[model samples]
Target: MSVRYAIYFAPAKDTPWWDFGAHWLGRDEHDNTALPQPLLDEVSPTELASITQAPQRYGFHATLKAPFRLAAGTDEPGLITGLRTLAQTLKPVALGPMRVATLGNFVALIPHTASADLQALADACVTGLDHFRAPLLAADLQRRRIEQLDERETELLSLYGYPYVLERFRLHLSLSGPVDEAVAQGVTQAVSAHIDRLNTEAPLLLDRLCLFVERNPGTPFQRIIDLRLQA
Candidate 1:
């Protein structure tokens, strides 16, 4: 029974980011209902749909703890307790302002400036619950292509079980996967409008953390638990 779970920042239900992300990616987090994708003239429906297929499964979130199986002897209740304990000690982080940014082949929202609190939150999630993380299997290592990692990244992978963390972590709500570089700017422009809509209301805050579960390989990750920061 191989299962994977992640600690993540999932926007509150009914918030602009949540609604827009769910509909844009065509997967509603609340009920896993299939929704319509954003209609954009710059990117044809076919192309947009194809690019979003990857992100849609995971729904909309910024990874705090990348997905991993529970370590031997650890149980679900223990993981939840660990998450709640961490949540109580942190404060909600205000995302000053964000814009569509390119990360490798994908496009997503990135903050104008990084927040120290956010960094601490992510680092805590990576390290605090680390004891609950099972060691990465050979197949998992191959999926990340450990051979291509730089020395420091390889070290991070070995130490933290994920390559992008600490100084390398960039909080992003992924919108697509492996898009064409030629149309990247246009794609960003298209999504920028949606992000603009998010600005019309209160600035988005990282007020709550969510637990996402993948019951098995190829299954859609579902947002199963939400914990509010006591502060």
Candidate 2:
């Protein structure tokens, strides 16, 4: 039997749906749901599913910390307590200007340039959560190699389940599924429209770090913790 585990800041269902529609459109065949038209016009249905499938068919979200398995003896409540303790010392980060771009096969809204505060928050999440992670599995090892992850990246991947962390981490709110080069340009433009609107305002204020978990591989991730950044 598999168990569930993750740490994330889940977007509230009504929080102005953005790029997620493309992913939803791509995934609709498997899990039919409303796709945001504003985004779909930019990419074909085929491309949407393909580009977004790897991360699991879900709506939009900013992954402060990627999900991970629990160590042999760890329990959920203990994990929650640990995260709460960490949140107490940190404050919300002010994201500088951001842009939307296609991250490899996946499409996401990324920082226009780079933001130290954002990197610091990501680092805190990865390091602070280390105590709760389960040991890396063979599959995890294989994935690290496939991604050509560096030492620090491998360490974080082994400890936190995602290769990109800290300085290497780029804040993104995911948009379509994985797509080939053929359709990537259009998807990027569609994503940019939404990103442009947000950029017009002051930099984004990241005040919360949330924990979203899944029971196991096939299940959708859900919110487990909404940790406010401490002052």
Candidate 3:
């Protein structure tokens, strides 16, 4: 199968955080349903859809292990078993308060303070489950634009089939993809205000490994299951 799988950290469904993100992106990956996006004076409904098109496809979540095909000897069941075993050995990590920020040309919600535990969790997901990941194809490497990456990132990509793993990983819940500079500030402010209105007194917790599947190329990924951390 040409299908690909990814491991991500997504807020539980029906929670305030999940609802807000899903509404903002206008799609709920959990059930593959369209949602009513928040209306902003600065951004029209048409413009909002254009900007969020990319993230909407992937849904609202932070990547733990980037998408990859199963290795020759591995199958979907084996991958699920591995994820379940890994989840049992882990404990939830607290991610302190998050703030709206622009990463490169995109906007995302990122932690105000970096969490070592979060990084470790991501590292474990990437390295521990690597045996099931197939090597990246030439098209995959080209799509990643390895030439644009730094030396260390290039090295990491060669080793892990992804450049932004381990040390290079920046945990974020993307809100927009390559925003237009003209309306970037307005979009940022709008998203910030919306997030501020949310009840964020409690720290966000990384409590489960969400399995997302892309059944075909150019298709939106769907949330398959969440394996809770037992520890």
Candidate 4:
């Protein structure tokens, strides 16, 4: 089986952010537990489950380096060593209060204000760890739907094996997959209400880089370890 790993910013366990996301997604990446999702008035539990299927599989987190297979000459131990070295030079980023927002066709938690520090951290994860990522296979490239992306995105995809990085990256903790236009608004509102109920008003902090692993295709990604930023 081909394993894949990804670098991501996931709020620590025991925190409000972590609890809310885990419950909302109906899975806890930290423990690999299936959680009971919040019940919404307008959306039935079955329908909510259907809509959240995609993000639930990936777990609740914001992608930093994206997922990739280990490159030639690089192993999991080497990747961890590299991340530990990188973590020493990085500092935690404070992303101001977040709100549920629609990005294209999906809903996600997005920061109210942009943070250069967050962008820098994501850029570092993508470029600094490029040596650990194998070149994208033809099947992988096809899966990304290259034809849907613009010129710059195509170039980034070719260079980094994933587009939506560096210049094009937008920090988002996805809540659902592609939502139908008819139900998008309701889903967003429901998520926002759920967040409000949690009352997690403090600014979101990007304090650690979580190493998430998928043992094989079609399997849920799970958190393996969290490397803190010492700087």
Clashes of 4: 0
The ten-residue window of minimal lDDT in model 1 covers 193-202
Candidate 2 lDDT for residue 153: 79
Question: Any runs in candidate 1 off by more than 4 Å, and if so which?
Answer: none
Better of 1 and 3 by lDDT: 3
In the range 119-192, model 3's lDDT, one tens digit per residue, is: 88999999999999999999889989988999999998888889999999999999898986766787877877
**Which pairs, if any, clash in model 3?**
none
Clash pairs, model 4 backbone: none
Model 2: worst 10 consecutive residues (lDDT sum): 22-31
Provide TM-scores for the models.
0.96, 0.79, 0.96, 0.95
Residue 2 of candidate 3: its Cα lDDT?
84
Q: For each candidate, C-alpha RMSD in Å?
A: 1.2, 3.8, 1.2, 1.4
How does residue 92 of candidate 2 score in lDDT?
77
Against the reference, the lDDT scores of all candidates come to: 0.86, 0.63, 0.89, 0.88
